[model samples]
Target: MSVTASQVHGAVQTLTQSSDTLFLLLGAIMVFLMHAGFAFLEVGTVRHKNQVNALVKILADFGISALAYFFIGYWVAYGANFFADAQTLSQGNGYELVKFFFLLTFAAAIPAIVSGGIAERARFYPILVATFFTVGLVYPVFEGMIWNGNFGLQAWFESQFGYGFHDFAGSVVVHGVGGWIALVAVLFLGMRKGRIRAGKHTNFAPSNIPFLALGAWILCVGWFGFNVMSAQTLNGISGLVAMNSLMAMVGGIVAALIAGKNDPGFIHNGPLAGLVAICAGSDLMHPIGSLITGAVAGALFVYLFTYLQNKTKIDDVLGVWPLHGVCGAWGGIAAGIFGQTALGGLGGVSFVVQLLGTLVGIGIAVGGALVVYGIINKVSGLRLSEEDEFNGADLAIHKISATSDD
Candidate 1:
């Protein structure tokens, strides 16, 4: 039988759609596993008494995030609804469905970031409520603005700056938003009971270095999918993004290793800081520019974390604010600088646009968190009672404690 041109086109389209769908499904799965990274990272950083709580909060919050995003957040972000019958929704080889799943993983990351910052003290139910609102309403508003062009902001940027603000993998949209929101929640919760006494900061060592290291490793490995698969289709994929991400990650490790004076926590977290910063410009920069960006992010995380911990009263349990918020913001700005052709980058982003966009995302995050957490504090309360907190969140809240051997 002779194949018509139309038939050939249709077959090619089908294959392309199937490939893209599988690609995104794999990316979603990788990102989903990052939640485990989040859980163990928090578990290791917190006291043993709170280990169970850390794990529980991350998993539960992910559940809440899925419902909120599937039912509400996705529509808000894209103005698309899944109200259609399954047959209709499954069109295009179900690429749209998998797309939602991919984005849902990113949306859920907001709560994962917050869990680390507020671990050991936050009440379980109240934090879950925060996750619902943050994922459903606050995060989607900005996600819509940047990714879907829901607002006129992108249009205005293109009109004036020659390009819209670029965030290849959500440095600002996901990490920045999550980080700043975590900062607000951290401030609201105040210091953990004995974090600061007599104006002296107390050090609470990690309960398990191995677990923390494992979490970092998972995040680092999964981040390839996070950054590269952001292309969303086989046609858009670029090896440069992968190369830049690797360079930035190593850059972060080396910078943190030096800046942190051989601190293992800093070393493990360094790659995360670099990855966060490189997310925005990963598609646009030379590997060298990416390395510098990651290095700057790593050093900035180390210094800001130290300053926030020892010189300030901020009790950010896992330094979420610095790791996500600060590094994310740096990523946004670095994209503008390193994405310029003058700097051996792709040359589309504007520094001013990047700055404005980053600031707006941060503002929205802070504002949304304040409203959600403030109301929860007033109505339902945000933290465990003094006695419950003293007993460790595991036994106090979950009634299951990890014994020393376990």
Candidate 2:
């Protein structure tokens, strides 16, 4: 018996769809593991008394984020819903389901980012409610404008600038948005107790360097999947994306090492700064361009994190604003610079459009976070009582510490 042309065609189509699904599923899993990285990073950064709260918040936020995204967020971003029966929903080999899984991980990151900034003092239930609103509505609105071309924003950019805003893998959409929102929440929550005395700031050393380093490592390893898998199809995979990501990582590390004067925390977070900056242009820039972008991001993170914490007296525990907000914004704008043909890049982006889009993202993120967090703060109060703060969030909120002996 010979294989018929129609059978061969059908088999090929099935194989292609199956392969794509598998690829996205793996990508989603890797991105999902980054949440563990987020948790451990916060655990290591905050005081030991607050360690368990960090862990719990990340996990809980993810659960709430999943619910919010499933019922509301996904629809806002992509105009798709899961209200259909299983068979109808499972069309496209259930690629849409896995796609939701992947994107939900990204959506959940907003609260994970805020968790770091507000850690050790935030009220658990209020923050969870804020997370629900952010994931369900705020994030997806901006996400739709950029990724889904909602509201003619992209069209306006293209019409005005001759090229539309181009964020290949969501520098502005995910990291930038998360970072800015975190900043707003941090501002609203105010400084932790005793962090400022006599108009001077105090340093709260990380509880565990090993844990922080471990989290950074996990995030670094998983970022490859995060960037590469944004393609969402096997045929779309690019070695350039992988190489750019590598170069950016090292660039950030080296720059952070120099800028931070060999501080262990900065050294560990350097690669993350680079990865965050390179995320937008990973597919378009030359490796050298990526390195430069990463280096800039590393220096920016070190400088801004220091200034924000000490001089400005903002108590952003994990420096999420510098790492994600600033660096991610840089990634969005850098996509236009390094992605220019003049700079050995693919050259389909416009700097004006990038700037405009980045500004829009920042505005929406800050505004939305302020509104959501402000309402929650007013209604339920966002912070722990001073007694609870001194006692630590782990014991106060969860009735347990990270270690049983504690």
Query: How far is each candidate from the true structure, as Cα RMSD in Å?
Result: 1.0, 0.9
lDDT of 2 by residue, 177-273 (tens): 9999999999988899998888789989999999999999999999999999999999999999999999999999999999999999999999999
Give the per-residue Cα lDDT of candidate 1 at 207. 97
What is the per-residue lDDT of model 1 for residues 1-406, given as tens digits with 9 covering 90 to 100? 9999999999999999999999989999999999999998888889999999999899999999999999999999999999999999999999999999999999999999999999889999989999999999999999999999988989988998888989999999999999999999998999899988787898799999999999999999999999999999989999999999999999999999999999999999999999999999999999999999999999999999999889888989899999999999999999999999999998978999999999999999999999999999899889889999999898888888877554
Cα TM-score per model: 0.98, 0.99
Candidate 1 local Cα displacement, residue 208, angstroms: 0.2
